[model samples]
Target: MTSSPAAEDGVVRADVWLWAARMYKTRSIARQAIDGGKVDLNGHAVKPARSVRAGDVFELTRGNERIEVRVLAVSERRGPAPDAALLYVETERSIARRQAEVALRRQHAGAPRPPGRPDKQDRRLLQRLKKSIRD
Candidate 1:
């Protein structure tokens, strides 16, 4: 197999790095995220082809979670989870914030929900509440 450009140089494309690091499932998805402005390098939005080097900081949002990582190595080939883990280090602040957000979600998720569809009386109350808000 042909070696990737990153094998020769110390830099790799941002999208490729993201996929290789397991941040995104595939390179195309990583490219899409970059194009959508969901990925940033050194605190600024970067294109998929942007060159990423060791020690560069990347902040990206994947679904509801925001992740920040510092690049430790560069690779273009997608690897195992453990290998991917070696590519970057998530900042401690990022880990703390993610944990806090997860805890908040867990707290809200503990709220009891109705077991089934709303009863007629419950639906009526909801309709009245909606009408009042529109008025």
Candidate 2:
């Protein structure tokens, strides 16, 4: 396997790095996230082409998860999962927060849910409640 460019140049573009590190499935998705403001580098919003170096911190939001990672290395080419994992390290606070979120979600998972679509009588009752609130 080829060594990462990080060892030679010590820098890579934000989107490329994200893809290479397995943070996103594709470079385009990484670019979209950067453009859509779902990514922040070193505490500031960064463009796809922004230079990323070792020790740079990143805050990324993917779906319902918020992640904070510190770049431990940079790579221009995608690699194996183990190699990708070596590219960055998730912060302790981020791990704790993600665990807490999972626990909270699990706690709410057992909540009693409505059986199904409301019947006509239930709809009428909801309408009445809405009307009362509006009055």
Candidate 3:
């Protein structure tokens, strides 16, 4: 695994650090979220290039989960899962909220789902109906 550019300085770019920590699968995606305001530092939105160091706090939202974590270590390298886990400490409140959200989703798991993929004819019919209504 290669280390990030800023790893030698004891700080890393927020996007790089987030990817390194396993918060997002890719640095580009993390940068996009940061640009879209889905992640914040100390309650204010931050740029993807913002530097992150140990003890910095982050609030990241993805789908139904909002995580608040304090940076425990800054590493530029994308390491193993266990090592990645050591990068940040999640807040207790954040943990509790995630658990509650998981439980709520589990309760809805029995809801009905569509039978299968819509066929080409069904797609054509839907398109015609939508066009007719719009016209």
Candidate 4:
């Protein structure tokens, strides 16, 4: 299937676009992820050069989780503070669900590890760390 050509101004790498869009933290990580088949656009796997347009839906997988995001604009380079925000939009529902999960996980993550057999040294370290964290 033929896709539309990239904007005449310039075509940016898909990975770069994702990073600039704040979908990913770093361009290299984005490219590695794409090359590793961790990224998809409109249900189709894409290389790093595939042109990105507004309203593009991308499914990205990292570790054991996958995320769906929509594009709002494309830029050849990462834009400045305000302009950078014109990049992509994570659906509200997606945001809510993800935030909820993160909140729940964080709640548990911050809890003390199950009280099991902790040797004297282990217990002391755990206590110190927990105390430090509390402080």
Residues 36-106 of candidate 3: C-alpha lDDT, one tens digit per residue: 99999988889988989898999999876899999999987788999999999999999999999899999
Local distance difference test, each candidate: 0.94, 0.95, 0.91, 0.78
State the lDDT of candidate 4 residue by residue for 32-118, as single tens digits: 899999999999999987877777888888765567888877776666767877676677766787788788888888776757898
Q: For model 2, how does the per-residue alpha-carbon lDDT over 19-78 read when each residue is reduced to its tens digit?
A: 999999999999999999999999999999899999999999999999999999888889
Write down the TM-score for model 4.
0.65
Superposed model 2: Cα runs more than 4 Å off: 1-7
| Model 1 regions more than 4 Å off | none
Query: Candidate 4: where is the Cα deviation over 4 Å?
Result: 1-6, 9-11, 62-66, 114-117, 120-135
List the lowest-lDDT window of 10 residues for candidate 3.
Answer: 1-10
CA error at residue 87 for candidate 2, angstroms = 0.6
| Per-residue alpha-carbon lDDT of candidate 1 for residues 3-121, written as tens digits (9 for 90 to 100) | 86666798889998999999999899999999999999999989998999999999999999999999999998898999999999999999999999999999999898889999999
Clashes (backbone N, CA, C under 3 Å), per candidate, total: 0, 0, 0, 0
Worst 10 residues of 2 by lDDT: 1-10
**Cα RMSD to native, each candidate?**
1.4, 2.0, 4.7, 9.0
- Give the per-residue Cα lDDT of candidate 2 at 120: 100
Arranged by lDDT, best first:
2, 1, 3, 4
For candidate 4, list the clashing residue pairs, or say none: none
